[model samples]
Target: MSKPNVLLIGTGGVGTIVAYGIDYAGKSSLSVVVRRDYPKVKDQGWEINSCNYGTIKGWKPAAVYESVSAAGEAGVTYDYVVISTKSLPDIVKPEVLAEPVITPGKTVVVLVQNGFDLGRPFIEKYPENVCLSGVSHIGSHNHNGVISHIQTDKAVISVFENPHLDKDFQVEKAKEFISLYSNDKNDVSYFEDTKWYRYRKLVYNATLNTVCALTGVDTGRLDLSGTLESVSIPAMREVVKIAKADGVELPEDVINTVVHSDDGDWFEPSMRVDVKKGNPIELEVILGNLLRVARELKVDTPVLSLLYELLKAVQFRLKEGQGLITVPEKRPISTKYYS
Candidate 1:
């Protein structure tokens, strides 16, 4: 089979990284879409560096469009749409989302976003087009326009499941991505009920991201044995509890699996980084969604509830004059630290 064409959206870490991955495949036709302000990235010519792959330079796309609308204006379509752009419903804007180069057999939108619900935004717009839920644990970031693959987790692509996934087509698409990512160490696991998996992953992320943001620790540092036993482990178990309560089946070994996996610590997540950069941390994404789901399922998240309360307190402190969300734990040597 011929290598399918892929158009990657989002210009942040994953966008650049996915560009590099597709380039490495050396088979797919790859195009990247960034915002108009970020058009300079096109001039730089993309490159990716990974501990696993060492350094790979020279990833010039067939073309780079400023926005999806621009790409649409130019009449560009792909067999696969890899949406790695984070900060969605904000970054991509409403106008460009689900605007199709997407049609059955014409395009399969592989929604590779974080924080779950890959099908949420798309189902409304392109009910007939395939929206396959996918997540990437690959830790690569654009450093001075260079894509660096620091680590990778299990990359999952969804079955069309919601509206457009014919079983045979889903299987074929899975194989295609498996072959695409096969060159790299990570494998593309396919799940039929992508939402539950996505939500389960969301619960996992709820802890990982909020704690990382609240404590201001890189995931890599905190996942160490002591932190794992203390903070990370307990937090994750809370997430697992929510998943089970909601009838989501999370593997017993997922935390172990993620930590031990190749790209285990892909550096600080976007929210933590946002906090450091003096931007609003993504408390809404991690906490809001999980809270909404918890309400829907009527699941108790006492530990998560505590985390949520603390996270809001921190956010309020940051905006309500202090302008910062401090670490989750109390200071090491303050009177309030212990008491």
Candidate 2:
């Protein structure tokens, strides 16, 4: 039997480890779409230092393409097209990226990005294709072409439940992906209700990821600064309430667990990293969408609301810096109070 062909888009911290996992699983031949770092990755390859796979020097996927269109033009129908890009709907849509390579009913579109309801666009766009939602709990970062895997390596994948597709068939394909993505080094399991898992992840992202980005604080400093008790826990509790209002009942202990999950580590969450790097954070998918649910359900999220407003200000500056938006010049006004 021939190995399954897998194509991964986005080679960030999370994407790099996922690429490594697919390669390490050995059941699939991996291909990657490299954008900015195409020349470096295509020529010199990646250097991955994983806690699970140890040190793998000069690692490259089975194939590499410069763009999704280029990968689509290759004439190879991939079994899975894993999207690990940041979920920034304000910037780009996931379906736009996956549509080029998707083979309608054949290819399974797997979303490994963060944020709630991340698979909806893909499901709507590729109704004939199986859409799977993946929630990964891994601590990894990519600096240049070198990857550093620090903490946990566990992932849960489940079908997004598209009415247009067969449920049983989706389950089988999800299992196949698990088989190809799991090994002794890392853990990948099948989840029945992945949205619940995504909401559970929100307990961490909505609170720590958002707060740290605003305060410029890392996980370890958050504990020492007393913000963990004053702000973090309250924000997490609100997320839990919002999740319940949206029909997902996360455990009461989730807040405590997510709080101490990074007990002694001085790690910066993804959002904070983006802020430091002057990159547009995943504001919409991470907090914006979740807050929308809260509003419709009449769930009060003062902490999250305030955080969102502050972060929106930050995102405005980032967008302006990246030239995604242009700011009009200020106009002179005469007012008695101004004197």
Candidate 3:
């Protein structure tokens, strides 16, 4: 039997682990799509220090392309197209981002990004394809070409409910993916339904991620500053409420479980890291979409709404810095606001 062909779209912290796990499994031939670091990565490869895989000096995929189109043009129909990019629907739609490599009825679209309803656009766009939505619980980073994996990878993967594909077929596809993705130390579990799982994770992401970014604190300091109890937990409750209203019944102790899921270590969440680096944080898919759901479902989210509004201002500044949008000086000027 021939090895399955996999195309990875992102090479960030999470993407590195996704590639490593798949490659470590040695069950599939993995290719990657890198935007700017293709030349360096192709030549020098990566220095990976992982908790699960120990220390790998230099590592690179079977092939690295400049873009998804380039990878697609290679004429190999990918068995799995794993996307681990930031979920910024306002910047780029999920369907549009993955459209270039999709093989209609043959390819399985695996979304390993954050945010709610991550697979909806893919299912709508490619009705013939199976979409496996996964929630990654790992702490890792890619600094330059050196990849550091601090936490062991624990992923929960589930097949999105697709009316076009048979239920049994979806399960088989998900199992095949799990087999190709799981290794000795890294744990990957398959679930029948992941909507509840996504919501459960939002209890962590939508709260700690936004709060820590806005407040400029790591998880430990945030907890030490009494924000975890007074602010983080309250925000988490709001997410649970919204989930229940959206017909996803999370456990009563879900918030507590998420709060203590990790030790109160001095580490920044991904959103906070993005904010500190002057990169645009994932606002829309992370909180904006959830807020929209709250509004439709009539679930009140004062904490999340306030965070969203504040983050919108931060996003505006980020956009200005990135030259995505220009702020007109004539519109309004307030030096005191910065102070």
Q: How high is the CA lDDT of each candidate model?
A: 0.65, 0.88, 0.88
How close is every model to the real structure, measured as TM-score? 0.72, 0.89, 0.90
Q: Report the C-alpha lDDT of model 3 over 51-108, residue by residue, as the tens digit.
A: 8998987688898898988998998889999999888777778689788888899999
On TM-score, the stronger of 1 and 3 is 3
**Span of ten consecutive residues with least summed lDDT in model 1:** 87-96
Task: Give the alpha carbon lDDT tens digit for every residue of 247-301 in model 2.
Answer: 8999878887898888778989989988999999999998998898899899999
Q: Please report how far candidate 2 places residue 220 from its true position, in Å.
A: 5.2
Counted clashes in each candidate structure: 3, 0, 0
Give per-residue CA lDDT, model 1, range 1-339, as digits (tens): 765777777766666656666766677877778763254567766566766566666556777888776676766557777776654342233215646556554676776766644465565666666666667767776666666677763577666465545667666776676566545645557666766677666644677667778887877776663664576667677667767777777887877765554254457866678677665555655666667677787877676777778888666655544433345566566565553
Clashing pairs in 1: 151-263, 152-263, 318-324
| Best candidate according to TM-score | 3
Q: Could you list the CA RMSD of all candidates, in the order they appear?
A: 7.3, 3.2, 3.5
Q: Model 3 — which ten-residue stretch has the worst lDDT?
A: 330-339
The parts of candidate 1 lying over 4 Å away from their true place are 1-4, 36-39, 52-54, 90-106, 152-154, 163-165, 184-200, 217-238, 251-270, 309-339
Higher-scoring candidate on TM-score, 2 or 3: 3
